[model samples]
Target: MFGYRGLTISDDGILEISGVRCDYLVEKYGTPLYVFNEEEILNRIKEIKENHIVKYGGVAAYASKAFLTKYMCRLIKREGLWLDVVSGGELYTAKSVDFPMENIIFHGNNKTYEELEMAVDFGVGRVVIDNFDEIDILEDILLKKKRSIDVQIRITPGIDGHTHDFIKTGQVDSKFGFPMHDESALHAVKRILNSPALKLKGIHAHIGSQLHQNNIYKLEVEVLAKFISSIKNLFDYEIEEINCGGGFGIYYTEGDKRLSISYFTDVIHKAVEECFSRYNLRKPTVFIEPGRWIVGEAGITLYRVGSIKDIRGIRKYVSVDGGMTDNIRTALYSAKYTAVPANKLNNKDEEQVTICGKCCESGDILIKDIKLPKLERGDIIAVLSTGAYNFSMASNYNRIPRPAVVMVNRGQDVLIVKRETYEDIIKNDL
Candidate 1:
């Protein structure tokens, strides 16, 4: 119910998404399916671009790691937002669609030489440098090619985010970027500035993922603004921009307090404005990357209930056809989600059941002890807020094929990603 814009309960008590009943989709496309609300995604993109980026005269890059397909890249391109790719495969996916290379920003903690060469060859808009070795490797490649590429220095601002430890990357002890409190950041700036093949355009920092506090982004702006001011005062050079890497949180359940896009943009904009004035320096353009926020709530996963195990005085386990293979967020990050009995929306009989996957592992539980309508065999279960990391992180673990992805709007369902076949799973094995 978090992203219930186009969702409605029919008079017969059937849950419908974008006017398409859940059972109808399951019958047509089969369960263990991924469905995205096309209208919701388009609206989120428009809101970010018009209400936030355009008003501030900055760039909005869609972090492809949240979700990426050739069609997804095309959609981001159609919206006129930049693409933020973290790996060679993502870059190739974008290139396959002929996504504007100049609107692409390449980022990674350990980028290979081939990836850097590919970025330079494709004339990528900017490369976010995370370490000193990357600087050396990039300079070597660019010098050999006699080409100059724009770059952004990713500095660790030492801000601890209130997210899972595995996703935190902005602290000083992290292995992501140059630490600002130490001399490493300054040395990196000097090294990049001296590289004849690199143009140091700006600085970049990302605290963590699924951040709910607006003050964190404000602090990021203040810290980055101070860094820019120091560079200007020390080297007498102006930083054109600062990419505050995206980690905006989204609501997956009723307990989540979602932050608006304007809350982020307005706070950071004011922080940048005030900080620049305080430091007596010119304001630089801002770049915000939002991946999950834009697409998280726009997607839902539909699965079919299979086996049920009842333990007296214990917990009732309801198994679904799909498990960690299709949605690994729960197993990987301990992420929480909400689900409903799509086929029995009006059923008054409710039970608290531990929804689990068909995986062989005991830790493959998707939702732990959730109240849902009494489930039965063949019941279609719709898991909400799965639009972000679910499909992108899907795997062929246990030889299970991934599910198909469909986009629905105004009652029309279009298949975007075809379900993986058993043959497709072994196609890569030699």
Candidate 2:
């Protein structure tokens, strides 16, 4: 099973997503292509909006760091959801499409002065201030521009999420937010409440990415609620919002436990309510910034098998046209994924092989020791659940041009991102 709602296997043993044949898309878009199911994406968006945001009266912001294109920004805006941008480039991408400025929230620990000025200029809804220097920078900018902006102070609640160390941002030792153990978070709050140019709205925290445990968010809400209650009592200020950064897990491999958006919403709502009731505080408006949950399963990457080298009693190396340049998760976080041969979806002729990228690096592996049908040259391979970070993190490693991206719905395909040309790789060269 593909573990996604949009996938289908044809009787002729080929793969189809949203009724569009994968082979047909490969023929038109070329190999190493990223295909997104628009219907599925919309469905996921509706799922979150109806089940999570509307149900609980919260704001859902799509984390643009996952896989943001101008079209994606438009899609999020069309759905009436907010957009989260961590850099000036992402902010500009959304602005280029005339997305609503008030629906954007700027986030980053070390936001540059230019990015802060841009956020201030655009009149973004909120800025999640991360550190002391950034507070100073934003205060100065707001004073000079004669603008007052709403902001939430990002706090480290000292809760360790069960995810990759690289992504665990809520721990006391993490570099992301002010730690609650010491006076740093408290000090930041005091400074923000005292600032004339910044309106201290609430607090924010992101535990980590790719999480499966339901209690993780419950724990996060507990820590955040306690901190918020104490701060509110200390400063006699109303906490109007609670921005819980999203990192909900998705199905990439069989090991992943499939959880629904409704389940995540239910647990978080209960936790937030219980914590608020315990602390004798009002339930502030909640905001969740989900990047991978809504888009991960809606995307699949198609790569062409180039060469197969079988070593006696050792391994079979099946190299594809793309590797770390397009998907570096395996090399970066040992992220696991499930892939199938698009041309032989139901084939029972299994063979053990390691799917590798064409990159020169030895660690540029895509999948390891997977049992699939005998793969041949030109066989189309579909790597599922790549919609989140694949294209967003792609690079020009080894000078391999990144692949094109297409969105499919109702048997219709539209190119969303053009395939990088050979010249595009060296365009910045002197």
Candidate 3:
């Protein structure tokens, strides 16, 4: 059974995503391709809009770091969702698509001088200030441009979301934001308030990724609300927006549970309303920056199984054409995923196999010890729930060019990003 909508197994056991057959896509786009179900993405966005943005009077900013391309920018813009960009390259991608400048929320921990200047010049709607040094740099850029920009100070509320240590960001000891336990956040707030070029718009915090607990989000709201109230009492500056950064989890494997959109949105809205009311502060425009939750399940990566190494009394290694080069999550975070032999979906014969990548590193395994229909050397393998960070975090590791990305809908597939070539690898080397 597929965890996400738009995926089906044909009568002959072929896997079809949004009505498009996996083997057909593999033949057309080649192996190691990223196929996103456009309908599923739209459905997720619709859930955000209807449940959170429209229902709660908030904003939905699609976290572009999850997956970004010119086509994706156009899709987000068309759906009327704001974009959260973390780097200059992402900003440029949005700009190249002629996306509305004001709908952009720029974020970066160590935003370079040029990146800040670029954001300022492009008239980004809000810049989430990550640290004290970035504050000075941004103010200088704004002063030079003789323009002011609305900004939000990212605060580490010290709430651990009980996720991966590498992805947990809102903790006090993290390198991301100004810690609230000390005077650093207050100092940063004061600095922003004093600067004529920067307008303090709100407070922001992203606790972690792949979060499932609702209590953690409620607790985050409480912390942010108290901080907002204190800032109002101290500086007499009322924050107008509250960006409870997004980490809504999605299903990756059978063990993973995906919560409903309202499950998070309703709790978030109620928490905001209750906490602000208790604090005697007006409710600000809430913002949710969801990345994985929006597109994770909508995506499936197709790879060609090659060179099966069956070591008796050991593990059978079913190697694919792609590995860390296409998806580093498994190796990076020890992430779990669900994969099947696309060509043999109806076959009942199964064996435990380790889906390894062509990369030289022993750690470049995709799924370890998973039962699948007996995998053949030329069979196509489909790994689900890869839409979020796979393409965005892909690398040319081991000199393997990144795979092409295609958006599939209603049995139609269109390439959004072309497959990289060896020339592209060396294009910047000389």
8-58, model 2: which lDDT tens digit per residue? Answer: 989999999999999999998898999999998898889898988779999
Task: Candidate 2: give the clashing pairs.
Answer: none
The estimated TM-scores of all candidates read 0.98, 0.98, 0.99
- lDDT of prediction 2: 0.91
Q: How many Å off is the CA of 105 in candidate 1? A: 0.6
Q: Tally clashes: model 2.
A: 0
Model 3, position 100, has a per-residue lDDT of 99
Which regions of candidate 1 deviate over 4 angstroms? Answer: none
What are the C-alpha RMSDs, in order, of all predicted structures?
1.0, 0.9, 0.9
The sequence of per-residue lDDT tens digits that candidate 3 reaches over residues 1-430 is 6666788999999999999999999888898999999999999999999999789889999999999999999999999999999999999999999999999999989999999999999999999999988988998888887999999999999998888898999888998889998888989999999999999999999899999888888999999999999999999989999999999999998888879889888988899989999999999999999999999999999999899999999999999999998999998899999998888888888899999999899999999999998988899999999999999999987899999999998988899999999999999996
Better model by lDDT: candidate 1 vs candidate 2: 2
Give the TM-score comparing model 1 with the true structure, all chains together.
0.98
Clashing pairs counted in every model = 0, 0, 0
What C-alpha lDDT do the candidate models reach, one value each?
0.91, 0.91, 0.92
